[model samples]
Target: MGDHQIVENAPTRAWVLHPDIRNFGGSGDERPRDPARALEEAVSLAHALPGLEVVGNEVVRLPKPHPGLLFGTGKIEELKARLEANKIELVLIDGPVSPVQQRNLEKAWGVKLLDRTGLILEIFSDRAATREGVLQVEMAALSYQRTRLVRAWTHLERQRGGLGFVGGPGETQIEADRRAIDEQLVRLRRQLAKVVKTRDLHRKARAKVPYPIVALVGYTNAGKSTLFNRLTGAEVMAKDMLFATLDPTMRRVKLPEGGPEVILSDTVGFISDLPTELVAAFRATLEEVLAANLIVHVRDISHPESEEQAADVRAILASLGVVEDTPQIEVWNKIDLLADPTARLNAAARSDDIVALSAITGQGMDDFLTEVSHRLTGLRTEEDMTLTFAQGKQRAWLHEQGVVESEEQIDEGFALTVKWTETQKRRFAAL
Candidate 1:
């Protein structure tokens, strides 16, 4: 079964939305979707969800700085009727709702309720596989949950593992659990700090090698991991689920025709309306992008919203201060899924350094690798020479420090053709 099919079977009813605060004249920015756009986006998100079915959904429209119920009384009543008629079990508001407002909405609807922040946290928690990633996700979740712990049943303030581990006598278990979660949050942050330090050391070491770091970044499920795997021979988890990869993975890959090895990094992908908490929590991990010698903005050429996705990625990168001076090459991936593949290829190839290729089929891999090799080596080449077999030390150093392209046996000695950087060439020149 496909990866998406596995998600499709999970049992849950998820309602989603994209709130347009611009309509309230918050900043005077015009939104084409407005409230109507939110409903459409919600339905689109619902349809993309795997396993658990969406029973019913309604986008709760809100004005700027909504005090209580985000929607007007009439709109709330309309949603109430729809929920009752449809027997909806959950109400998911597509924006951050305060704890009091969330509780009030749940009580009125007589159903569980979640805001966009909570939903995104749940998705991140579910998708995180590595220990470090899980710690980071849980840290973000606890930070979000802290504000929503106003009510007693919220179980937001109990510390476990002590005689009076629970909250005050009148407080419920939920309150105690929340407190425990908060304590765990502190511990997790310390652990992640250590991980960050280790990552920094790796970065320092990588700098000594002088290989250009090429980072693959784009919208979630934008074929980044696929392209990374294709380029680096790594088996990182690649799936259709959102946030499938939370931790960055780097591998040294030799480009085609035997150029020097380059460092390639696969990073967690971005989304259009990513939660603020997640962005803040993942910042430590995202520092990898800032140091990238080159960035590959990978896009799924087949997605209907590819342009929007690309714009979102650029916006996020610009926000993080990583795009100003760093060089970027747009990679339109998954052309195998598109009709008139050549047309798509031609379109992407317009950029000075763009390449269109199918990572799965190995199509255009040669052209793609050649471009990569050129970028990493800065348009340099090597010379061909022959040396006596007795030059054992020189031969070994050439093999170790430079890329040996071809070797042949001759009666006098050996014929060796190799590629090396300018520094390496100087080092070999003395020999």
Candidate 2:
């Protein structure tokens, strides 16, 4: 019924991509870059996909990058052969291929060829269950499709009935449709601007409540939803799939030690080679991460490309001006899948700002919460302060707001000892 609620509809498919060109960026790590790892990651993403199956996959080794098609002629032939051999009807490229390249590749392969951008867009399109999310996806899709119109509307010599036909057959139906879609995109942008203003107003209202927003950001299918559900007790869509969530969901979560409730926001997950079009389109959604007071960088500890994916998320966040300066708690999720858990723990400990936890099994959740508590409250030591019944207001405030570490009955009056925030301490002092 609400945008926060998950939509239980839609069928999706996991298409295969040629592993040879699966490059997002250079990793400084000396570990060998395995393309099989990319394919495995892609399969993991498919697990979270509802009503979808990765029926097949294939990789094409091209001679070099061609300006128009990205792959050379001989490699294109090999690609065709592989597609036929594998009975694969759809191909996905894990790199940023231009619209021209996409069209040319599809023509050469004789099947749907989706570049990294296109695949991401398709996932975004399906994940966009809300009206605003749909608007954002549509805006991005239109921007992407505008350049590929030549493939879908090649026959431009049939215009006749339109009043603007004076411009000749070149000004055809397809061109008019493109113009109309452009106009619609303008309207959609305006509408989304209004929605953004509304979200801004809501954010300001939230600020008055004084809850720090801790956003979970990482590569897609990194168990962010599962972690969010575990922390908030909200049954969000959590599966072993990619891009399962497109809309940002926020919920109030209680701290382990009865501390102040914090706003935990689960945003749309990031990917290794995210499309620029989707990035620009979903900038409004990602603004949540930028505005958050704290960020939890959730990583799939079991993923082979976990380090690389972490780097990708970090790079994207830096590009968005959301760097390490913000209070960041790296959460290494899915530790249950690891054979040597302590090794993973040691790896996480190396970061000094990281917490190892398995969202599925509730392992290390307590330690993770403690780490978050330290980051948020900066509570170094527990203090026991005595207050008299004469300070009835202060006692009541402590009972209502602060966590009572200890209580005692003094000679003259009731002595209540409690733990409070720094601001709460200042308020208490003023009282």
Best by lDDT: 2
Q: Which 10 residues in a row give candidate 2 its minimum summed lDDT?
A: 154-163
lDDT of 2 by residue, 1-431 (tens): 24235446633344666546433344535453576776666655544434655676655444346889787777778767866776665676766677677767777776666666666777788788766788999999888888777655432222223344454436466689799889989999899989888887787667556566789999888899999999999998886667777888889988988665789989888876566777788876778898676799999888877888899899989988885557788899999999888988987788868899999999999989988877777732357776666888877766654345678888867755565455457656887
Among these predictions, the greatest TM-score belongs to 2
**Per-residue alpha-carbon lDDT of model 1 for 199-234, expressed as tens digits?**
777666666564667888988778888888877777
Reference-based TM-score of each model: 0.71, 0.75
In model 2, where do residues sit more than 4 Å from their true spots? 1-15, 19-33, 42-53, 81-87, 155-175, 347-352, 379-431
lDDT: worst 10-residue window of model 1: 152-161
TM-score of 1: 0.71
RMSD for each model, in Å, please? Answer: 8.9, 8.7
